[model samples]
Target: MKLSLFLVSTAGLWVAANANSVNNKQTKNDVCTHPFVDINGRCLFVNNFAQMDWDAARAFCAGFQGDLVTLDEANLLADIVDFIYKEGLTDRSYWIGGSAGAQTGAFVWPDGSLVRMGTPCWGVLDNIQRPGAEPNEKCIALNKDNFFFFDNFNCEGEISVICEYKFQRENRWAEGGCATMKSSAVFVFLAAALLGSDGATEAGSHVKTDVCTHPFVDINGRCLFVNNFAQMDWDAARDFCAGFQGDLVTLDEANLLADIVEFISKEGLTERSYWIGGSDRALEGEWTWTDGSSVRMGTPTWGANGQNQQPTGGSEENCVGLDNANFFFFNDFPCVTAMSLICELKL
Candidate 1:
């Protein structure tokens, strides 16, 4: 009878220990508060509580075991904007994890990855309202008033902040690292919904795997190299790209212009113009890409309102470039004028 009682007691103890372990796992899974949301497996906390300078804002996020939100993916950025809009914080600016740091205009995230430039990442600031040259603006903020486009602000300036932590639910945090969500269907649907037609291709869609070599960014399956090494005239720039099995980049879509601009801005070339592949050399008043395709004109294509702003230099300015003076707009310039250039390679 004593042996029977001892076995029963041991079994009961084992059951109690297992129950406690399960409860602990459950608690960890549901860790975040009401204000935080699970976005693509990351717990994002949007702090609109008070405005603080960039350094202070970073400290606030760190206090919560997170860092200022680092938007490394384009789709993730779209989701963040959607989340902010849903929460009715569209009027306020929020500090994110990006700064030009010691290298002005070379924005990098906390993890040492370079921030992606241009559209969907940067809000389109009105050309007329844009500050005429503020080199002091090194830190980046989400200008919610302008649809969450990243805007450069002084580091010392006070702003709200967004904090993000790697999702540690499922007891994966202690095992090795943060656990990635396992649903492929969900990832596909999210990418489609956030990016729509203009954003980058779907996650697993057939895109060129091997386009250009190292140091070139892949945009919409095309490899683009922004040449900071050589500044040459339009023809000479074209030759430089040719040497690398590519040509000066040709802006096919209006959205593409933004991506190129972002790349240039991130490269710290905000004040320098770069040659793209567009010229009326074939027929006056009619632009054609180097590959012999007709240029798309008008809204979403040309910067600064319409075609009137572009090809403005008349017959003399045949080659096209992204103008530095008005960074968002394109301007016609003499083909012989020396400038930085962007090269593109298709897979």
Candidate 2:
């Protein structure tokens, strides 16, 4: 009797432990609040099963933290279907990530244009082409009712959707080290707004001295100062700025202008003819900034239309200057005179 009682106690304990383990797993899977299944390193979600239209299904995916499936990798898609199966998702038709929405002869994911193409397979047999396959349908749909058969459906037709967000490894900086990523560099600039361009000058002086004054901080970029009083052709000024990892200074916003002015004031550049942003390479009659942005600043320093007037003969003037007056517009100048420029780079 004692032996039987001991055996029964052991069995009861094992059952209790097994039940607890199962409950823990269930809780873990249920933790995701978004309509998604976390698998491998991505979050996957499927939209409701309804025949609405492609656009509607896309919007639904956007709402649920993903987009219509653009399966670049075959294994990933298989994993997704397995998840759907476990969840008892019986959506007969589902939209996926293949579309020729932008142009013919090419397929692109609606999510982003940067995704690279990978092995294409569909359904149980992993066949890209099948009998009666309408390759020109432009959009693909998975028919779950027919055991996940792939179909080329009209883009206008509505169906369910699946979304996936790949996991990104956040780069954490070591202690005492600054953020090193490009995005982090932008954030650092925003946080401090430290003055200065990424300009530099090599030491040619024979005298050993700490006599030079720094008008701005390096912030991992360089800065160059041009005396406004000095007359320089547009080309020379551009070359000068280019030598320092910058282009001819173009002021698109008031705050940017203010920053330049602050730097100039610190550098004691009070009365020089600095180069302004103007280029006419693309369209001889039209003016554009160095970055190809539109030159929309009103009331240029060289006077309105003063820099843009078409002269009687020489090659269309392609450069401009900022006079002591109307500071925004460019005054036409030749391209080869040496002038000051500001260089910039993300720290």
Candidate 3:
């Protein structure tokens, strides 16, 4: 009955561009890691069974390596509403990412991007926002009773969290729309051709044969091994790579970074986030690889959550990993979090 009611209110939904609304239709980029579902190119984790206050909800989502879902686009909001109704979820208030805590009346996502205001985004009654006080409140959510439009509620109010994982596809091929959803095999081939990769080696090729024979399938390129089977914390993951005469993977060339990401995404190895070799443990913000080389920061290298930059976690997240949410772009994660890893050693 909820979705049925929402379908008739479609005219109220308008399109606004944001990280999660890049695609018009529902298409999955990578397989949603268990407990998440593909919704219009976003891997969403919906927990209607648990309820927590605004702050607690944020911490809960972070445990899953995601932030609260931001519904910047009208269509995405509509899709989520329909999804809840169809999935037989209870018609109750849900927590979203926007917050006015920093500055009252101005809502922003976790990455500090201003939450789009007005319109089909907010519920209106007689052409006026249902609750005039909502805009000045601290946290934002989809008011289920208000036809699922953005509404501000007190931060302490208990509610279910709907988080969105920020998955990015920043490969150079995207300039021509290559990132657009397509068959896995076709996309992989196109990416390989454009980036000069052959998918030549499998994950199991970490064994050595001769002086010229190495575990990786390469001639002179980086000897890298993707560990898709085991998951471990940052230190343990690094030790595993050490046993193979390698450390966590590090990137110095932009093109090589692109190739590795494409290989992982296309080859279906995105089920979990990966531990790379960059960490700021010695000095906060001084990111360096295991060999003590500096790690690159900023666009095309570090991924973003909406408008929020990567490595924004500050002191809490000292280790860097290729986040699945950012399409393998570098993301700062807590060292304690368990994940798969990439091992690299020069041949």
Compute the lDDT of residue 193 as modeled in candidate 3. Answer: 18
Cα lDDT of model 3 by residue, 143-175, tens digit: 765555567788899988787665521121221
Tens-place lDDT per residue, model 2, 1-347, is 00011112321221011111111322233333344444433445554444567777777666655577655443344444554564556655778766655644355555433222211133222323221245546676665643443455777876666664322112311111111112221111222332433233333211112221232232212232344544556666666555544566554432234334444544566556567657666776466877676664222122332123222224555665553333322355555645544433212
RMSD of each: 17.2, 23.0, 18.8
Ranking by lDDT: 3, 1, 2
Error of 2 at 231 (Å): 82
On TM-score, who's better, 1 or 2?
1
- Between candidates 2 and 3, the one scoring higher on TM-score is 3
Candidate 2, superposed: residue stretches over 4 Å from native: 1-32, 111-120, 123-136, 165-347
> Per-residue CA lDDT of candidate 1, range 156-180, in tens?
9998888876443223321100111
lDDT (0-100) at residue 87 of candidate 2?
A: 52
RMSD of 1: 17.2
Q: Give the range of the ten consecutive residues with the poorest summed lDDT in model 2.
A: 14-23
Model 3 root-mean-square deviation: 18.8
lDDT for predicted candidate 1 compared with the true structure? 0.60
TM-score for each predicted model, relative to the true structure: 0.44, 0.34, 0.41
- Evaluated with TM-score, which candidate comes out highest? 1
